[model samples]
Target: MVPVAALAAGAAIILSGCSAGQVSQTADQVAAINGNTAEAGSIALRNVHIVFPGSGTHTNTAGGQAALALSIINTGETVTDELTGVTTDLGTVKITPADGDKIEIAPSETIVVSTPSAGAETHTTGETVDTEAGTTEAAAIEITGLTQDITPGLTYNVSFNFKENGTVQVEVPVDAGIESPRHESELSKSTTGSAGGH
Candidate 1:
């Protein structure tokens, strides 16, 4: 026959074991319930527009320096999670005519950000300068660091680096296929053109 104290201790051990099992079961159930409800969200950039400062022909002496403006509407619902970094891939930023010059773009909001174009000093004497004739430069604007959340129905503006001869600001339109140069090895050698801009 066991002593009364020993019986009490044994019963207590059994109760504790039961309690632990119940707690583990409850936790497993809660996790299973949440697993089904979890879903992934998305973000989209849309209605992008890049505009040149002036439609008039830029002088070759002004070093073909010009300004480019851009407007873009970022339309997408924010994720419950946070995005740390969002950036645009502006290919090799360089001034036209290979004058060894460069462009600089001052960062700003949705409004115009002034980026200088290449000047005439960058071009050779005999070269007939056109918008594309000048050296094309590329610079990426980092948008991810600006905010914690890029919420739905919000617009963010990013400016490219200035080109010495002239600035080519691209307006990335809605669903515009702005390919990533980092992935394309060939883009490193290809020249950037003014295909779509205002």
Candidate 2:
């Protein structure tokens, strides 16, 4: 069982950059509003957002790569967890972290998966990614062979596979709201990088 205090802290981290009725809402918010559970085993995923290209309002073209942003909090006190990969109906999520490894969270630690360095942004085009490139701490997932079946403001089924716990499935929201400060920071850096490149 997850500690109440730990869950509370996890909730706080998920809500750090969000408010009500906007993209600021975390994955927990989406899950709660959608009547789903964001916690699985000792892993709790929150504040998840998907990007469909062309800012927060436009949708990505078919075959275009999409991005994702979310936070994972390990509530276990003694066990560490590994996020092996992500999968969707479109196919397996192909993201080679600039750092070269799957995400591993220590007990009671939280890791946020966001934009990748140079290759892709959290959920935007290369132009969009250039506006938010600095930290490669987060993993950047590039969805290949994507078609027009997905769109923004809609929900999709995604599975996150862990080394020990197996797969946890959830519906992720394609949010364009810049409510998450960390999420926004990527944009800020992207803007800076874009300007500096000239």
Candidate 3:
């Protein structure tokens, strides 16, 4: 027994609620990252992850070597900083610079660090520096004598010691190498099929 105006208003409200697009619809459409990040003072470490040993191998055995990959950014406008060293309970981190023993980062500069020894097949973040462009410098951060297996889905705590920024501890993960949701779904289907056969 509602009035015509009331009924129309109700209908309008219902139509508005059922409209096409929504902010919540886009909520699930978010960006995904593979690595962890940490900030200390003016320095920010982005995409800190460990490269799995060799291509096709998903795990690195204990006591073996693993490469740590990350980009160190100096956010300060004027103050230059130096990466003094890196340490972790997992192993000893050797910082091999392209030129000298010192890893220097000028203000507003980014130093890309990775383990080149792991070879190009497995390296995820450690990219080669373009010497022709002569813009960014690259260094190698290798973790040797690992106490535990370095595998995907496991995170290890690593400390980055900067001369000016002190020390920042970051929990870094090993790369699983899954690039998209479809890839994950396909793998899941195959896994399900395998389980059903057993």
Candidate 4:
């Protein structure tokens, strides 16, 4: 006959191992929320406003260059909180005018950057009259390196530093908000409380 104590001890060891695995899994889930995982209620940018001289434009020798400025605001409560992990799809900044032509403004503040361009002026007769010296294709600036804990009802002012054709330096804004993730369990509790009060 087999000994009962030996079987009981073996069972206890198995249960202990299982419990440890469950705890590890829970920790991993929380870390995913902090950075890796794209769970529901993720962070996103909204209401972005880019302020620069003449609506942000860009031009190249091929006459296909376009200039564009960006003003982005965090929209999602959860995604905003994870700004540190946010990566911009735009590559880099190039061909800035001699005078530093890029600035980032806040909700109530503004900055200016300038670029100059000179092109020919055409007359109604399809003849080149005279080249008007003015700002041609504007420069395009994009923001990168966005990461922070975003809060609700707050705004941040970030700057994008352009390179000749390399990575840009995105300055972190001082007014950014950091918000905590909301737990669904709290809603359940509130519902239960309301039902009991009735």
Which has the greatest TM-score?
Answer: 3
How many residue pairs clash per model? 32, 8, 0, 24
RMSD of 4: 19.8
What lDDT tens digits, residue by residue, belong to model 4 across residues 69-187? Answer: 32222222221121121123332234332124432122221112222221111111111222232112222333322233223243334323322111222322211112335557754
Error of 2 at 40 (Å): 1.4
Using all chains and alpha carbons, the TM-scores for the candidates as numbered come to 0.18, 0.56, 0.70, 0.22
Residue 191, model 1: lDDT of 62
Model 2, span 131-186: residue lDDT tens: 13122245556566666556656877888888877788888877544342343565
lDDT of 3 by residue, 62-103 (tens): 887778777788889888899999999988788887456788
| Candidates arranged by TM-score, highest first | 3, 2, 4, 1
How big is the positional error of residue 173 in model 2, measured in Å on the Cα after superposition?
A: 1.3
lDDT of each: 0.27, 0.60, 0.74, 0.28
Clashing pairs in 2: 18-24, 27-47, 67-123, 130-190, 131-190, 131-191, 132-186, 132-190
Clash total of candidate 2: 8
Across residues 1-198, which tens digit of lDDT does each residue of candidate 1 receive?
Answer: 579889999999888787575476665654221001111122222223322223333221222322222221112222122222223432212222212222222121111112223111122322332332222222222121122222212333433322222222333322111231345576446566837546
Off by over 4 Å in 1: 1-102, 105-133, 144-146, 151-153, 157-198
Model 4's alpha-carbon lDDT is 0.28
lDDT score at residue 133, model 2, on the 0-100 scale: 19
| C-alpha root-mean-square deviation, candidate 3 | 6.4
